[model samples]
Each structure stands twice: as C-alpha cells, then as structure tokens.
Target: MDLRSHSKPIEEFNFLDPAVLDNPFEYYRAAQEQAPVYLMPETGMYLVSRYEDLRQVLLDTETFSNNLDGYGMLQGENWKVHQGILQERGWPDLPTLNFTDPPVHTRYRRIADSIFNAKRIAAISDRIEELCNLIIDRFIDRGECEFVSEFSFPFVGTIISEQLGLDSEKMSTFKKWGEAIMAPTSRVMTVEELRENAETIVEMQHFIAGKLEERRKEPRNDLISALVSSRGSDGEELDMMELQSFMRQFLSGTYESVVTMISHGMLILLREPGVMEQVATDLSRVPDFVEEALRFDTAVPGLARLVTRDTELAGVHLPAGSIVMTRYAAANRDPAKFDRPDKFDIDRKDKAHLSFGTGPHLCVGRLLARRELVIAFRTLLTRLKDIELARPLPEIAHVPHALLRPMKELPIRFAKADAA
Candidate 1:
C-alpha cells in the first residue's frame, strides 16, 4: 500500500482531530518520512514517529522521564483545576507504575513483577483457556454476536476483576472507572466532564481502599491479597495512597488494551481472506497472528513522556520539560523497521513491535495480555467457524479518544464448528 501522498503539510496536521484519530496512518506516514520528531502545533509536544527513535526514547529513561507530575493528561489551566478537585474531594492522584521514573518506580515495579511473574502466568493459563471457552459458549450457538461487548469486554474484564478480587458482575462499573481514569490523558474534556470523572475516580479509590483493608485482615488467593501482603526490596509495604494509585494503574492499563486487541484481531480475521482458516487449521499460528494484530493496530497507540533535558531525536531538537508522545502505532508501521509495514502479514519474521512498549516501562501485564489473546483466539477459532462481519466496515465505529483506539462494537456472524 502506498502511504506516501498526504494532502496537507505536516505542521497543519492536528492530532486532536477526530477524523485523524480514526484514520491516522496517512498522517503517520507523512510524519515518518518528513519529520520523524514532528511537533504538534496545538500542544507544543514533540511526537516521535520512527521505531528506532521511539526505542531510543524508551531506553534512555534519564532523558525521557515517565513522570508527568499529573500533567500527563490535563495541562495548564485544566491541570491546575484537576489537582484542586482531587486534593479537595478525593485522594491526591499520584504517579505509580507507568507514570514514574526509576528508584521510586523500581520499588513499585519489583512488587508488581513478583505478582505477575512467570509462575503466576503459567498457573493462570488453564483458567484463561477455561474462561475463553466459557465466554465463547455464550454466543457461539447464536451464530451472531457483538464481539466487543459480548466477548472481549467480559472476558478480559472478568479475568482482571477476579484477580483484583472485584465483583465480576460489576465489570461495567469497573469499565467506567477505567475510562474515567484514562479520560484526562486520552482527550480534552469539558470542566463538567472532568469534575464528574474525578468523582468517579475517587469512588473507585475508596472502593479499592476498602478491598485493601479487607485483604489485609483476611488475605485471599487473589491479586489484592498478594498486593496487600507483598513488600518492596526495602521490606516496606505500600501505604494506602500508594496502593490506591497502583490499583488505579492496574484497572486502567489492563482492560481496554486487551479488549481492543481481541476485537481488532477478530476484525483482521474477518477482513483478511484465508488467514482465519490458516490459524484454525494450525493453532500454533495464533501467536503470530496476535503479534501482527498488535502491530497492525496497536491498542494504546502512544504514551506521554516528559523530556528531562535538551535532546535531539531523529534530527529534531527537544527542549527540557517538554512532553514527548511516543507514537508506538506509527513506529510499529515504520517501513525502515518492518518491510511492507502497512500490510498485516502474520508470517513476517520480525515480531519486535512496540505494542507493549519497551525498556523499563514496558507493559507489566504483557504476558497476561498475550496469554489472554492466545487462549481467546485459539478457542474462538476452534469453536466458531465461518466468522464474518455482520455490518460493513464503515458501519463499525471506534470510540473517539486521542490515546486509545477501542472499537465501540464488533458485530460478527459465525457458525459453530463441529466438535472435534
């Protein structure tokens, strides 16, 4: 596919435009070729679009700090107002896993890493497969279902919710909390919306605080229990505010990205001829398909990094204290890195996409997310056959947000495969 011809100049491109957000490849291609470190005129933030450039930014943690001082989303006037609201009515919004630099981040990460270690992931594998089959069983016989709401949402939400010892029946409520937590970073909201989301987040924090206290008293075989009981390298347990902040990240980071991955992966299967058949025929290929799906349409396209000092990336100079948005989706499709980057070729040998990020701040839940996708698609292809889009491509809509590319719905029609 030719990604060369953009109608407008790079400087004229507005990252906040909903149209651009919906379909950003053309703009991404232009920026990659013309200005790899393009500055957004509106936000004064530098957008690093090249794969190597983004990788460099991620590795050089000293230069590109993750802590945005609660400025990751709300900026200037909005940020001041947001801080006031949280301080007065709710817990002070503090940086945890994805928002902090080393030393401090290391303390939090060490605890999180132990909880989501290889053993834990392996132990949960059987349960993941079982959940996949159970979720599939609900809509497989119907021959038609909204993939996002019916499958991806509940499947991922239940697993994460259960791990956190939350009520699975209240997945919808959890989703709202996640969205509210992410709203400030994803898009510019009105003051009213910000206040409302702030209230919801405070509610979520209180709810988590209550859970933490319960776990402290009577530890259960759940993540909340583990977190409450776990200690850092210094043998210091996380305080109440720290625990609340960590849970906030866990809730926001774990859910939507996986849901988007599953839904988008299904969309790819329906769009690409014979790919589904290939995966169904040989289950081993599901992993490759998942990797390509992640590369082709990265769920969390980019994340904000605070520039700690003056730096030059891809020939563009960045000043200290500036916000740099690493465009992982664009970097994943960089022609310099992946040949035919725009095409979704599962057979391609290179699978080093920035979908889960890299370096110190790499996604903590990547293993779990990958396991969920593998089990989900593997079971989905095994049980459901002849999957096709129920509606036309244009009819399917994505939620309008700057940071995430979550599909509003994925209506699909399929027939149940004969039991083996």
Candidate 2:
C-alpha cells in the first residue's frame, strides 16, 4: 500500500473523511511524521499523535481538561447548536463520566464503581461465558452468519441492557438509541443528525427516569435499584437526574465499543491465516491476541481535551481553551513505543495499549469488555470448527464514524462442533 497516495497536506487533512475513517493510520502517520503536534484546519484543534505526547496529555489533567464543553466534537458551532437545542426544550445537561474531570469525575465514578468491582466482574464471569454460548447457539446451525449485527452487536448490547434492568427483548432498539445518543458526542453530525440524536436522547432519558421512579417506588435486584438505593459518602441516595446521567454514560461506554472490539478481534484473527488456528489450538493465548488487536486497530481511536492553561508540549505552545485531540490509534502504533508497530503478535511482552484510554478517564467497563471478548472467543473456537469467512475478505468494511471503527459486516461460516 502506497501510504503517500492517501496522505493529504496538513491543512487539508480531516479525520472524519470517509477515506480517513477507512484507514486512519494513514493520516495519523502523516501527522506524526510531519510534526508531533499540528493544528487541524477542519476544527482548529491540535492533533497529538506520538505516544509520549498523548500519555503526558492524558495524565496532565491540570493542563488538559475533559470537560464536555471542550470536547472536539462539541467544540466550534456544535456546542452552541447543542445548547440552543436543549435550552429550547428546557432540558438539563446529563453530565457523563467521559465528559468530566476529577473530583466531580471521582464522585460520578464512585457511584458506579461498585457495579464493576472485582466481586461483580468475577460474579459475571460465568454469566458472560453462558451468554457467549447462547449467542452462538442462535446462529450455529445457520452455517453462515453476519457476526457484527447478529452476534457481536446483540451479545454486548443485551448484556448491558440486562445489567441496567432493561427489557432484553428491546436490545435492538437499545442499540439504535445508543447510536443516536453517541453521534453528536463522537463525531461531526449534520443538523438533521443532531436533531434526531437529541430526540432519541430525550426518549431514552424519559425511559431511564421512569425506571428510576419504579426503583424508588418498589426496589428490585437490578442495576437501576442498585443505583437508586446507593448511598454516597454523605449517606444520601443518588437523585433521579444523577441516575439518568450515569445510565447514559453506562450505555454509551459499553454498547458500541464492546461489539467493535469483539468483531475487530475476530476480523484480525480471520484476516491473518493461521493466527486463528494458533489461538484456537491454545485458547490461553486468546486474551493476549485480543490485546494486540486493540493495539493494531483500537475501537475508540481518539478523544479530545481542552487546554486549561498556557502550556508548552513537545515545544508547541498552546493557549487556554484550545482543543487537543489525542490519537490512540496513532499512539498505539508509534514506532517509538512499539516494535514492528503494525504487526499483531500475541507473544509480545509490551502490551501497554491505549485502547481503554489512560489516566483518570480509563474505561470503567474495561474488565467486563475484556472478559466478554475472551469468553466469547474461547466459546467460539470451542464450538465452531474450521471457521472461515463466508464472503470475500476485501468486501468487509467498517462503519464510518469519527470515534468508533467497527466492522460493517462479518459473514462467517463454520461447522458445528460435537458436544464437548
């Protein structure tokens, strides 16, 4: 592949373009090779591509802020549009975990920390394994299946919905709602897209608020009840709005990313002949393979932060309120950080990938996501024999988004294995 053909002059580069979304590493490499830090002409935001620069920015929260107001997607006219739309309807802003910094972030993170604690992660291990088998069972006899929509999407979406005490039967709708709510925050959306997303968010919020009220009236052994009944350090229960905000964060965090991780991991293995066989032969390596897949092609490739004060990083002076975008995909593949950066090797000792992000904003659902992938792959390899792509490999493309990179479809065929 001639990388130069894909390269655009720094002034013309736009990560949201369809070509870049197809292979962002091309632009990431161009940016890194040209300069570690360069101002993006499309949004007037600085792009940080080097691993060290990105790591320092992520850790230096004092200088780099995660306030939603400064998020790259919400910057420029997007924020004004969003605020105006919400103000028109008199809606309250639902402060999400990803959009907040420490102290406040600490408080919100604590509210949901118990739900993803060691005990909870361990307790759900078996459930994850069971769900993997059940999901496979649905399409096993079909001989061929669309892995993304039919398998990965529903598998992770249903688990998240179930965890939130939502109707599992509505998993498809939940997937749609998740997409809508995340659109404006994750990428550049058209005015129509923004309006549709706002409407979907309002509908989802009403649903969550109703659930909160139900849990308040008659508590049950579910996440909504758990959250409603949860007491803070001050021994006060979380209010309805807080619960709604947390629920939005929970849904956004897990829904698309989990499915993307699973589908991408599998796609990586399948694309590389014999790698799948190597992992399938020794299932213990599945976890390491998953990590490498994350490095090679992360789900959430980049995130944005606001420059909080006059600061100089990598010799580039940045003023307060400037938006900085950290490219995790670029960082993960930085040759300065990883040897043979583009190669996927499970045996590599250096596994410090930025796929789950870093510093205070590391994904809270990291453990659950990893466990789901490992269990899903383990179950898949055990029950499906001689698995191979049901369609031409080149035909497989990713859903175009500014943040997420998930397979559009993965039609796979396999022979059902005998009872183990």
Candidate 3:
C-alpha cells in the first residue's frame, strides 16, 4: 500500500520538481496515507490528495473560491506587469466562467451550458467520426506516425477552431495561441516569457473579437455566434470582455486537455496486453476504456482554488487567502474510493473519478470531449491494425507543466486494416 516508502519526508516533497512532475503517483499515494492535506513547503499551497477531501472542496465552492486573481503565480508585481501588457494591447482581463464565483459565474455558465448542450454534441457525432477518419487516413498508409502531432493536436485543434467559425487550416496557429493563453497557469514564467505570452494572447483576443463582431452582424451556426446571440437569465448578452474571456477559456481548455486525453488513451491501449484488441473488436467498449484512461492518467493533474474564508479540510486548518490545489490526479487513484486504484481496469464499476471535476463548475465541454475521444479511438482501432510503439517507453517524455500532463510525442507503428 505504501507506494513511495523510500522517498523523502512528505514535508520535503516538492510538487514542482521535474522528477515528481514526471511521475507523481507514488508521491500522491504517500500524501494520501501520511498527509491528506499536506502543505507544500515550497509554495505554501495545500495539496488536497484524498478523494473524499477533494470532493468536499469541489462541492463547497463558497469556502474555496475559483478566483485566481492576485493568487498563486498571478500575484504580486508579476501579475501587475502581465495585466499592463493586456490593457495596453488588448481587452483587460475579466473573470468570466472558470475564474468567477457563483452568482456571477452562474450567468456565464448558463450561456455556456446552452451552447454545449446535448443536442449540439449529438449533432456533431458524425462530424467527429469524419474528422477522425480524415486525420487517420493521412498517416495510415505510412504504417508509422507520431500520434501526438499527427493525430491528437490537429484533430482537436481543427474541431475547436471550426466550431468557432474559424479556418481549420489555421489549426497550428490556433494551437500556438491556445498554448500561449495557458502558459501562465501551466508553469512559472519569467518576466520576459510572461510578456511574450501576453502579446500572443492579445493577438488571439483581437482575432476572436473580430469573429464576435462578425457573428453579431451576421450570426452563423457556430459557438461564437451562440455566445453572441444567447442571453443570460437577466436577458443581457455577454459584453466584449466576457465574450473574449469565454473564447480564451474555451480555446485553452478544449485543445490541451482533450488532446492529452486522446494521446494518453492510445498509450494505454499500446501498453496494456489484449486491451486494445478487445476494444478494437467491440467498438462499444471504447467508451469504458476512455473513462478508465481519464481516471488512470488524467490530462489535468490538479487545479488551484483560493480559500475565501478560513476553513478546515481533511481536519487541517486552511487559512483565508491560502491556495488549495484539488489534486484530481491523486484523488482519482485513491484506494479508499477506487479498488486497486492504480490498476488500469476498464471494467471497473466505480466511475466517480473527478477528472472533469464535480459540482457546478464542472467542465461544460465534457460532453464534446467524451464524444471526440470515443469517435477518435473507434476510428483509429477500425482503420489501423497491430498498433505498437515505435520507440521504447522511456524515450517518450511529457511536457513539464504545473497543471496539465501532456506527452511530447507518441511514435507508433501500425498497419492499414484493409491492407492487413
């Protein structure tokens, strides 16, 4: 049960360490057993590792706020400098959906929920499968390809871009913009890096703003148009700042997490014996496999929540203004909540993993994400045969970031199903 028994003291464990970032499961296991709510000596942030504790924090948003303004890396002089850059070149930052607390958050969430409704997602099912097939067709003949770049990034980028009424051919540009927008939260950046990222973000803001104007003038059946036309409970439409914020969140949230999820799911199939074949033979099993992949190696390891009021979690006192990171990666593997928590069992009955989070702030685009994943794997398995890694597992590295777990590349070999 003791995963990292030989590791250093819990107090000395640095969550930001490269080695820890690469493989934090053992540390997570140790944290759950030793200190469910361990305070990181490096950042003074509390790491909430237990499943029940994270669930409690997520449910009680009043005590633990989602607002990151003047918190974590966004605090002090750095934040001011970053905000200055945005103000000078683009729309000033605003807390819209993911960054706002209830009452205010409710308005944005309602609009978002309406846009990403079940009907819209169901309607896109065929399009998702079509995109998957088209992407797979490009490399299927080669018998070897880099899955991350060749499949995952383009597939996700094109979908989100097209949904925003953008040119799918500019998916690479969109991908760059999305990464720039997410840089600050993903990891600590130098002043120079922050400014560079800010400039790119401003570019994106202006681009999306132009699109919003087009939608306002002549609305279309696209997400941007939905954001422009839809009214909140107050019957007020979202302003420019609010529209830009939603686009920013959507671009960053959708592209990276879903892309990583798809990549990780494929890696699992390649590693696990007989699992790929089983799912490939019966396409219905792909959904279960997708859920298990999410639980086993979630794209987003954790997210920060600012403590609004002094509170206690897992019996540990968390003072007001403290940052509590809901360790979704750790909680998903908690043995107390999941049997054989570390094992990648697709048939596992418990599906309560907090990968997309829980409560009101749950990811609005989860339905689209799940649909994309299912269609993606189903298409890949159907089109390719004998899928296996082209390089050793140790050679594949993950891009180091504080929030997301994304693999750099996944080189693999496969045979065209028809040719086979």
Candidate 4:
C-alpha cells in the first residue's frame, strides 16, 4: 500500500476530498504510515492515524488540547455558529466535559466517577438482562423485524432516558430534540430550516428545566435526582450552569454513541452470516462480538486534538495550533494492530482498539454501553429463533454524515412466536 505517496506535501492532502470521505480508509492508511502528521489542505488540519501516536495524544492533554477549533473543524462550523448552536441557544450544553482538558476534566470526572465505579457496574448486570428480555419479547414471535427500530434505536434511547428519569410521554420529543443538536454541520438543514430547528432545542431545554423542577418537588431514584442532589466532594452543589452542562454531557455521548454500537454491530453481524450463526448458537460470545464491531467500524470515527506546543511524534514535526485528527477508523484497522482488519471476527483477541478512546478521555459510560449491547444481542438472538435481513447487504442505506455508523433501517422476517 505504499504509504509514502501521501507524504508528498501537506498542501496536496485534501481531508474532505469526496472519494476519501466515501472511503476514508484508503487515504487514512496512507496518511498513517507515510505521513502520520500530514496536514489536510482541505480542512487546514493535521492528521494522525497510527494507534501508538493517537494513544499518546489522547493521554497527553498538556500537549494535545480539545478546544473547539483545536478539535478539527467540521465543515460550516464557525465560532459564531458554534456559540449560537451550543451556548446561547441551550442545545444540550453539558459544560463540554468530553471536549474540555484536565484539572477541570479531573474535577468534573470525580463527580460522576463515584456513581459509575466498579461495584455499581456489577450491580446492574441482572437488571440489564431483565430489560434485555423484555425488549426481545416484542420481536421474538415475529422472527423477522427491523433491528434498528425494534431494538438498537429504542434500546439506548430508552435506557438513558429511563436512567435520567424522563417520563414516558416526553421520550419522542426528547429524542427529536437530541437529534437536532447532535446532527453534524455538514448534515444540518438549510439556514431557514435551522432556525426552525433551533426552536425545538429551546423547547427541549425548557422540558429539562421543567423536569428538574418536578423532580425537586417529588424526588425519584434516578440519574436526574442524583444530579440535582449531587455535591462535589467538597459538599458544594452544582451551579445552574453545571447542571445544564451535565445533562448535555449525558445526551451528546451516552445516548448517541451507545445506540450506534447496537445498530452498527447488528449491521455487521447480519452482513456476515457465519458470524451471526456463531453468536446465535451461543449467546455468551456477545462480548467479543461487540468488541469486534467497535474495532471494525468504530462509532465516532475520529477524535481531533490541538497541538499545544511544537512537538515531534513518529518522525513528524507538528507545528503549534495544528488541529490533529486521531483517526480511530484508520487506527483500528491498521494492519499493524489487527490481523485481516477488514474481516469481522466474532472472536478477536486483541484489546488494542480505541473505539471508546484511551486514557483520560476514555468513555466514562463504557460499562453502561457494553451492558446494553450484551443484553440486547443475547436477548434478541436467543428469543427470536430465525431472523434474516430483508434485502441484500449492499442494498442497505445509511446516513453518511452520521458520526455514529448506524443502519438507517434493518428489515427482516422471522418465524412467529409460539402461543404461551
């Protein structure tokens, strides 16, 4: 694959060139080996695709930062637009925990860490299994079903909403409002359409505020009340802005990415009948299945960072202010990291993939996400005896701008459930 061809000049590199966007790997692989720090002339940012380099950048917050501009620019995402969409408009702004750097990151992490600790993880397994059973029951009899709409879409959607204490009536609106905020700049609607969409965001913020008020008057044992009642180790309550920030954090990563895992995971397994059969015969193989899916098609393809000071990594001298893209899509598939990286294996033994990231910014909600996938997969396959895709694998549709690679829909037909 002669990676050196891409090392010609930074000016020659076009990060968003149409072909590579459709097929990023062919270019990304070249970038990783030939020019691990090549600059993208199109977006005016540096690209990093190797596993080792990305791991370092993710860990060294001091060297690599995540300020908006530093995080690599999404097309049409300007500062004024950023401020308008994320801040004043109140579009699920959770204080930028994932995008913010240390000291602050450490401080904020401790607040949620206590709740997401080891014991808490072990405690939820049974309940997750139970929820898995209930969700699978709907599709069990039908055998054939749209996997996304039936399970993945609603699984993450319902799990987090339930965890956060959102009521049944408002779930649909909550999801719609969430989608509007998280849509990539390239995918967002036209200017007039955007203004119309912004109103939905405003209403969502109001809904959250209203729910907070209600929770205060009548408390419940859920994430919302815990957040409302939470105090820093110092016994200080989170300020109004902090509460808003926390909720935004929950929505941005937790809901979208986890749901992405299920949807994308199902798509891959369905495409490979052998893999599906392997899992169908033994539900216990789900953990490996989920891990392989993440490695094969990581949900968030890249994590961008800013170079704080002039530094050289892997023979590339990066300039300060270089917007570095840690391309997970490339890194996970790097031949150096995994064997036959393209072929989806149900029993991949490597733990080198960075789908949920590595080091400081490693996904905090990882436990919850893994549980959801395991439960969902085991439940559906076990209960629904024979399920198959409705159309050919290549005919499936997907929303390209989706940072989370989820199937647009998954139509299937299976045997009917037996009468009890």
Candidate 5:
C-alpha cells in the first residue's frame, strides 16, 4: 500500500492538538478516506479509524495485546515515581483485568462477572432509582443546577464509593486521586504536576491497601469484600496486588465513563431542540435517546493496544510492539456502517455502536452504566418540569483529554415537582 495516497503530510495530524481534540471527526473522515489505517509518526501510534477495520482489530485480540507498553495507567515518566513508591511499600505492579490478555484476562473477567452479573444489577435497580431521586431532591427545589459537579460527579461518586466499602468522606478524595492518576496518561505534564499526581497515587494506593486488609479480616457484602474473598474457577483468591489491580480498574471504570455519559447525554438533549421535550412527554423514548447520545458522542474516544507480532491491518504493515489505537468514537460514526452517521437519530434501525467497545476486552460495567443512564433520565423527567438549558449552548464547554471528551459544566433549569 502506498502510504502517500492514504494520508496528508505528517504535519497535518496531531491528535493532541487542541483543534483535533475539540472535534476529531474531520480527521477521522480524512484518515478513513485516505487510509483506514494510518501511522502517526509523531506519536508512533497507528490510528485505526473505520468501523469494520476497528471492529476487526478489537475482535482479533490474538494479534493485539491488551497490555500495551507505555500505555497503561502506570505509563510515562511520573508513573515511574509512583512505581518506586509502591515497590518501596512492597506492592506489586497494579495490572487490572483491562490490562491483561487471555487466561489471566479470562480468570479476571469471570471473577468480575460474578459480582457485576444480571442478578446483582437487577436487585439494585430500586436502590439506584431511589438514589437518583434523592440526588435530584437536593437541587430540584432550586430550579437551577450545575449538573456535572452538583449531580453527576457526587451522585455516581457516592454510589461507587459505597460499593467499594469506602468511607463517605472519601468520595471527594476519589475524584482528586482519579485526576492525579489519569492525568499523566492524557498528556505531557510539568514537574510539579507529575510530583503532585504521584503523591496522590501513593495516598490512594495506601488507602485501598488498608481497606483490603480490613476486608480480609472481616468480610462485608460490598465489592471490596468480594475482591478479598471471591475465588476463581480454580478456587483460589487473588493476592493483594491482584485485588488492588481489580479495585483500580473497577473504581475508575465505574465513575468516569458513566458520569461522562450521563452529563454529556443531557447536554446533547439540550443542544438538539425538541428532543428533551419529546422524551419528557413520552418516557419510552428515553432509552433510545440515551443510546443515540452514546453513539453520537462517546465518552472514551479510543483505546490503545500493542501489536504482539508482525501483522498487517487495513493495508498497513505493523511491526511487533507497535502501539495501535482503536478509535471507537470514529468507528461509531462511520458512514459505511450507519446512514447519516453524524446525525443523532434515536430511531435508527441499527443502534449497535462501539461506545462500550467489542470483543473480549469490552467494558465489564456497561450494563450498570446503561441502567444508571436510563434511571437518571427517567427520574429527572419525573421530578423536574419543563427542563431547559439555564445558559446558552456556547457557554457550555468540555475539557479535552487524550482518553476522553467530558463536558466541563452543564447548567440547566426546571420547575420542581409537587410532593408525592
């Protein structure tokens, strides 16, 4: 394959560039047009954009390893400091279910499935709905709210914290620790930023380690106890390091993507005229609308995989150890896969999207996420009357990152409901 025909000059593409981060579809369109697979020399990443190609890569996990070098949570410079701190404390490298390949991945998945199964989720549906209403009650009377900080973060954060058997006071601390741990993966940071992030990483790890010991001594019904006591098919429990690894992945996965989906999904309804009113009038369409919102704008845009062996993908030859990025956001909007790809149509016959990914490494918490979104919108529609944007669309903005596109704030107004 002639590389010249597929992509413009290398100078034309820089994913980290602010312009690209703001709107990546144009770049995805160009890449898919020229070459479904294009090598980004600056970042040493082979970006796979088209729907079919990305889908193939996701399914062909044998060729692509989940554990990509220099791409995990513990990647880059600052993490080295974090690694040293962990080693000094005798903690092993925290590799989670998402960061491993087969056998190990299989075992971890089974363990995770036991807890995040249909039975467990269905049992909690009422509690989740009750929690949603409780959260809304705090702000519903005000007739105005900053949805992200006031509701999205704390609402989801508190639930996840409770599941993990953490103290109520630890909710805010989790966000700080999450930012500190994930910031390094998104971009280059200053020395001060790196140091601060490393320090927080140590703090969070210490806290979790203590909880692990507590669960070991006196098991409870929460996820922490499950991690401490749950046995694999072989009837063996994960060691402390393994347990911590699962905790990191579970906590991060639970809070970040779910919050992004909920907050951004609402933002989409606000931007698309009449959509909110449509859902408000007819509650049945809420699920479809949420699905469309996820497809239209995925929270986690893409994920990285390391090429395990010399291989060819979409006409591009990739050497072993190459970093390949599967762009789920781009794949979700591929014209070949969906008609009028850019348009947000809830009634589209084919609603299958890669927002939660595909194949073996697909997000384990997807069911929980979908349920949360549905209940959130349902409760809002029932509790608040005549919902509308509190501020102009232009004022609403997003914070860009390499891994995600999250709204910065979402201000909205609505009338409170009568006491039931």
Candidate 6:
C-alpha cells in the first residue's frame, strides 16, 4: 500500500509550512485550476476542489469508500487513535469516525443521530441562547474581545460539556488538548507532543468512561445517559468500547470545527462592517451571514480520501487505490458557483455553500454548530457597539494546520450594540 515508490512530491504538501499553511488560498486555487482531480507530487494524493467534483466524492461513499485510510483523519498519521482503541478494549478507547466506511459508518451515524437529533437540539435552543447572551454580556462593555478565546471557545466548550453530561472543568482540559491535536504545526507541542497526546487521549477516554458509568447508575436527560443506557432500533446499548469511541469522535471533531466557525466568522465581520451591522440589527439573518463566512474563509482547508477502487472522477481516470484530497475552502469560494465569490455578502441567500459539505456524510453537528454561531453573532452585535480589527489583517497570524483554517488571536473592542 506504500505509494513511496510511485509517490507524488509534496513541495506543496508542505501543509506544515508556516507561510503556505497560514494563508493557502492561492495554492488551493492553483491546484483546483490545474485539475479538479490530479495527484500532487507533494500531497501524495488526488485533490478534488471544484464544487461539482468534491460533491461527487463525498456523496458517493460506496465508490469512494470510508475505511480508515480512505478518510483523511485516519491516514498514516492517525494510526495511534484507531489502533490504540482496540488494544485498550474498554473505556479508554479512541472514538473516531475517521476510520469507518459505510455499514459500520451507518451504525455510528445512527448512534450520533440518537443524541444529536434535531428535536433534541430544538429542546436546548433556549438554553443555548441564554448561554450566548451571558457570554456576550461579559464582553459587551469592553466593546471588543478575542472572539475565539473570549467568546467561541469557552461558549461551545461549556455547552458541549453540558450536552455530554461531563464536567465544565474537564471540558476546559479537553479544549487545550483538542487545540494541541488540531494544530498540525503547534509550536508549543514539539515531537514530544505526540507522547503527551497519547497520555491525553488515554485520560480523555477514562474521563468519558467514568462519566458513562455515572450516567448508567443514575441516568440523566443528557446525551451520555442516553447513549450509556439507551438502545439502538433493536433496543440494545452500545458496548463499552463503542460508547467510548463515540465520545472520542464527538469531542474531537466538534472542538476545532466550532473554533473555526468563530474565528472565520469574526474575520469576515470585522472586515465588512456593513454585513456586521445588518446581522446585528436583524439577528434572524445570522444564518445567512454565517453561511457566507463558512464559504468565505472555510475552516477546513481540505480533506483527504484514499481511493479504494480504480475509478473516473470528473474526467480523470485512476487506479483502484488512490488518495483523494477534497478542498472545501477553494470550492466554497469558487466563482463558478458563487456570485462575487471572493467578496463577503451576508445578503447572499443561496445556502448552497459547501461549508457543511454535501452528500450523506453531511456534518452531523452542523445544526448545533449554526445555533451556537447564531447566538454568538447576535450577542456580539448587540453587546459590542463598535468593533474593529485589533491588528492589521495582513500582520495577524493564522492557525498552523491544514486540517482547519482559524486565526490564533484577534484583538477587538466595541461598545454594547444595545444601550442597556
């Protein structure tokens, strides 16, 4: 399975390169233009960035496959998460959907569905709004704040913990751990970080397991209690390992993804004050603004998939096994699909953005993610009377990872949008 003998060059796959990683629009655009489907000597895989082309790969999971290697998350670099879980065989397991294809993927989807169902989300809508207001209130007087650290990170951090029936304190710990893992080029976590990650993942598994046990003895109205004691359609609970695996996936995936939403969303609003004013005045329009933000600065730069069978995508033909990298960031901003694609337009009503992805594997947490975003922007708009970039946009730094596109820091100040 080693493609090293016939591998592509990754001069571009210097996905870890600080300059390229921090701002990758031009590279992604170039790759998409060269070929919607082409093997890079650099990334060592096929990249699908055109909106039409990427949709085909994600929607048609059968031809594409979802096995560990096929999906980007479980590639060679992620061996520890998948294999380690099996060895532990219990509470301390890595719950990653990054490894499974369909049938198995379907099972995990059902488990996720049971808890993140739309109705359940609706039930918590008010509470989420309340939490958003509370957080916004804290920063409204200051008028400006670091949206990621001051707002998005802790808001979702607390809310996710409450949903899982875990402790807020533990959720804080997971936030740091999640940031480390998500930062592909994290300076703080050197190679030694991997060893620390092993320890963190193990501790995370145990923490979830303990919570699962607690929920079991005294079932609550939360997602964990439902998973620990609830049944599938057949009325049987997920085995211990399955339970832990689910939590692992849930926590890891959402942490950075939500962080991306906040960071990208702030960057756009700060740059385009008219959009922010409209969104602030009419909070109902936030979803559209958020959608634009998702497309304008897509958090996930791209996703990689290894082809399991020889096939034709776009017009390109390939062998049975190939690595496909789909670039959502490029496609979202593609002029072919979006009018003024390069510009941020909240009034753009077409919600066809590829930010949440297309096809069966559509992001499971999208609804919740949007809810948090809506509440967040509404609060930011009303709380801060005026907000602007704390630093020059060009000088500001970006997160050092290809996995998600978010900034590390943003200094903003504003007066409460509301006089009260």
Candidate 4 per-residue C-alpha lDDT over 106-128 given as tens digits, one digit per residue, 9 for 90 to 100: 77788777656667656767766
Question: All candidates: CA RMSD in angstroms?
Answer: 1.7, 2.6, 1.9, 3.7, 3.6, 5.5
Per-residue lDDT of 1-420 in model 1, one digit per residue for the tens? 578554367877788877788888888998888888988887778889999999999998999998875433654476666667778867787777867899889888998998888888888889888888888888877899989999999999999988998988997798898788777877667777777877887788788888899999999877889899998888889888788888888888889889999998998899895888899999999999999999999999888888999988887888998989899999999999999998889899999999999999989999999999999999998898988989875542677676788888888998889889
Candidate lDDT (C-alpha), each: 0.86, 0.79, 0.86, 0.70, 0.79, 0.70
Cα RMSD for predicted model 5: 3.6
Candidate 4 residue pairs that clash: 94-245, 95-245, 141-417, 143-414, 144-413, 144-414
lDDT of 2 by residue, 1-420 (tens): 544335666556676677778777778878877878988876688999999999999998889998855322553565666556655652556665767888878877886787677777787788778877888889898988999988898889778877787888987679878887667655666666666666777777778877778878998755667788887777887776677667877888888888888888878878886788898889998888888988988988877888989999899999998989888889998878888787778788899999988898888989888888888888888988777889875532876766677778888998987776
Of models 3 and 5, which has the larger TM-score?
3
Candidate 3 lDDT, 147-191, residue by residue in tens: 999999999988898889778998778888988877777666778
RMSD over all Cα atoms, model 6: 5.5
Candidate 6 lDDT: 0.70
lDDT of 5: 0.79
TM-score of each: 0.96, 0.92, 0.96, 0.86, 0.92, 0.88
CA shift of 32, model 3, Å: 0.4
Instruction: Put down candidate 6 lDDT per residue, 99-164, tens digits, no spaces.
Output: 566776776777777778889888888888888887777776665677778887878887888888
Give the Cα error of residue 175 in candidate 5, in Å: 0.9
